[model samples]
Target: MAEQCKISAAIVAEEKSCVLKLDGYSRAKGLLKNGEFIISALFNVGGHDWAVKYYPNGIKDHADSISLFLLLESAHAKDVKAKFKFNVLNKNGEPVSSYERSDWGSREFVKKADLEESAHLRDDCLTIRCDVTVIHGKEETRVPPSDLHRQLGDLLENKDAADLTFQVGGQSFSAHRCVLAARSSVFKAELLGAMKESSAGSIEICDMEADVFKSLLHFIYTDSVPLLEIASNKGETDVVMAGHLLVAADRYNIGRLKQICEEKLCTHIDSNMVATNLSLAEQHGFSRLKEACLQFLVSPSNLEAMMASDGYEHLKSSCPSVLKELIARILPAEYKAAKDIILAI
Candidate 1:
């Protein structure tokens, strides 16, 4: 005899709620007469359209009271069963009054005189919270996680339907022209615009390393960079790669990638990398990265170490004005410390 396993499931009700604030409540009462109503903006609950109808002065015979109703806005919906609650909220957003109903019905929620005397109405405004629970006869299936980026990454790795080639630092890379164009404005212009290289079979990229170009293509296809993960394990290589990739991202007009590189460099600031990062920030007009570098240099040891680093001479040569600005930034604190010492003496 073979053993058997059993599966079980239960019906679940989907619940969703929204808050509607009625500003200028006094003005609304003056403008909207008895039996006249204003409907809240349409909202979605349980994949169906719904809205709240507010009667400033009560409808029909309940003229002295305020009325509220929930409407099913889906045109073709029939016999849709739902349990809903209406609550009037106080200034602190706690419920002051609560009422529950099933299906659909209008309630003379509160008398106008009672509302005016109550704490729920304040500053000429009123807030209502609507809670909706849609009952379903059967359990809904769970949705699977998306693998779009993985599929695209696989396509890039396989070089499937690749239509363009780039030669960078003696290594060749193959890619789909449409994908590149879609991700980068510079690529769009170079590949589809009137540029001379648009017609070329294989274009040569100068001044960029093979690995940097490879990572750039990976981001273009998958919207991610494995270099960040590598940064956690192999520190200096990924940081250097990020600097080169920042330049490439700027060249290609890829805003998001440029931001990612800037953020990575900002977080990885050190004595050896500060001068180079400052130079890059100044050259690229990256205000946030420049600010981070300046903050890092505020420490005397960090500043001293940065000046002794290999890239300091390059920074001084390429950006003499920035060095002057740095001196100006440092002098005030030094002067304050000197003045404090004099007072102590």
Candidate 2:
């Protein structure tokens, strides 16, 4: 084993504190209906991960109060040794209440009815300060980067001694069987599992377009989509190709690529393409994309012109369910019929 060296106390000790401000606290009122709303992410304090949890209207038995607690996220080899201080700040940036403990374990920091009053919960926002000092902890080893991923990407790009060839839309693309198998389970089953294609040297794919297949191959090699790969004089082609790529990705069980295409389609959606993209989203069962399309159509500014657009009929014919969702959003509950809602719009 390599010899270890220890630094002096002043240099060895590392303490971190953060002022967590929960803004728009009222906007998230519905979430508090279930239980406490914990801060979404972990915080680093004295080289240890910690979390702050908040109960907007307090825990079940403590409904009159707002509760806050400090949580030690990582499993302790022994009982974690630390000191903690919790402070609730008022709107003027002054602490209304403060609590401190030395050599403490995780526990509830505050439970107070004062938080419900305007002085503590000003403008529907709350701010808290947490300080932590770790008395004992071990350092974590840093991870080293592996060159295997880079080598595989380079090999795929150069078509270096490729072991398999894929014929997509009559276009031949060469890649390593192992690399494809590792990135996608669909490819894994086709090339390495008991499927008949495993024994074959060349595989044929007819459903996906040549350009979309190329994009899928690119994602398998690099874990990203190069949007400029199929740029054409008509800007509309990029959006259309991304939609096709998303479908191909779903077929191949490449979730990340599907998400990438969904986000790209969302950014490029407009009056001309919203209907087609919505239909694609509905067909693919992508809720985010479907929601985006509904939001665009429901907006008073976009609805009038979008209804008159050329693609609107295609959207209605293909994804009529989304039209119901639009109607629900725009019209009152009394107007139940789709025709009435359409006329109201």
Residue-level lDDT of model 2, residues 181-270, one tens digit each, is 888999899999999999899988887888788878878887756443223224787788888988988998999988888888887778
Give the per-residue lDDT digits (tens) of candidate 1, residues 119-208.
567788877777887767764666755667757876987799988899999999999888999999999999989998678879999889
Rate residue 221 of model 1 by lDDT: 90
Question: What alpha-carbon RMSD in Å does predicted model 2 have with respect to the real structure?
Answer: 19.2
What residue runs in model 1 are displaced by over 4 Å at the alpha carbon?
A: 1-139, 333-345
Error of 2 at 309 (Å): 3.2
- Superposition TM-score, candidate 2 onto the true structure: 0.52
